[model samples]
Target: MKRERDHQFECGICGAEDRYLLHNVRHRTPSYRRLCTNCLLKDHRGLFCPFCFSVYEEPLPIDRSMCNKCPSISHKPCIPSNYPHHTPFICPSCSSPNFSFFNPTTNGDSPSGRIIDRDSARALVAAAKIAAVSMTKAAAMAKVEAEKRVKEATYAKKRAREALERLAYLAAKEKEIMEGKGGGSNYNGLYLAPPPPPPPQITGKVEK
Candidate 1:
């Protein structure tokens, strides 16, 4: 009897060691099938077993209509028999069904059941895309508004500084005038006063 030798490899997704192992060897031809650490993070399509969740990557197509469902190209199936019952039940990339489904929700509340028609599914996908776009636009608008406010504040501060400078200059000029240091009034005859003479005292003495 030949003792089976085990060859283990790291998971491509989470980098878990020894999560994946070589399997299904025939006549010395090595057919690798295993899961790793990294696969756990993916939704359903790219998930992996608990032991291999750390190393598994997204599965790839090995042949026509046949894919390994793991990160690497191997001759055997990566998903174990107890798949879909694992965590992270859906693929983040394509949103395909994974092997982790337990008591899967297949129908609607109606007794007859609600079939997912192609139009409805397409509409749902479209709606999700539109919502995402709207969210992006909203974020951009918020950023623009913040920039506008900042600019307004900067302009206001500048205006205030200029006004203060002008006020200081006017005050300095007024102080100089009060101290009689201003050369002379620029208004020469704009405000001139005349002298008045008095003759009432002489008239009162003559009458007495």
Candidate 2:
């Protein structure tokens, strides 16, 4: 018996395995290749489809649109057919108030009014990631600074309390010294009379 080979697929762009097969229609002879969902969407050069959360290379006959306010792109097939139509579509990603289909304007303007190419979008995402990291670092630095300030403040308060206690102790000591001097004594610049001279020596115990 012959063993059958398992058909395994991998995406050429992202090196993902077991992906969907996509047919390239650009060539005169159509060729098929496997593409992961991520690669497929990335090729579309837009945000994920709001309805399917998938990416597409181009707006197909099925339906496709872009949000004017954000990078969100959508496919009509992913949404209910009865979805209420609005003049400008609201972006489900960023919820931008403006939106439109990915179709060229009557004046031959480019499709998807926004001029974000795949490379540009990648750059933007990279920049955003860097900005986020910077912001996080700044916040951490700020927190550290705040903590340092708090510690310094606490130390200062402790010093102030200690100084006040020392002043109080000195005041108490001075008061005690003053009270001690109240008694008649030659202490603290005060003088007191000596005891009366010894009684006249009993000179002669004279005539008993």
Q: Each model's TM-score, in the order given?
A: 0.33, 0.36
TM-score of 2: 0.36
lDDT string, candidate 1, 152-180, tens digits: 99999999999999999987876676456
Tens digits of per-residue lDDT for model 2, 101-156: 22122433655334554543443343333334435656666689799999999999
Question: Model 2: residues >4 Å from true position, as ranges?
Answer: 1-113, 183-208
Clashing pairs in 2: 41-55
Predicted structure 1: clash tally:
29
Worst 10 residues of 2 by lDDT: 22-31
Candidate 2, residue 20: the lDDT equals 29
- At residue 176, give the lDDT of candidate 1: 72
Which segments of candidate 1 are over 4 A away from where they belong? 1-116, 181-208
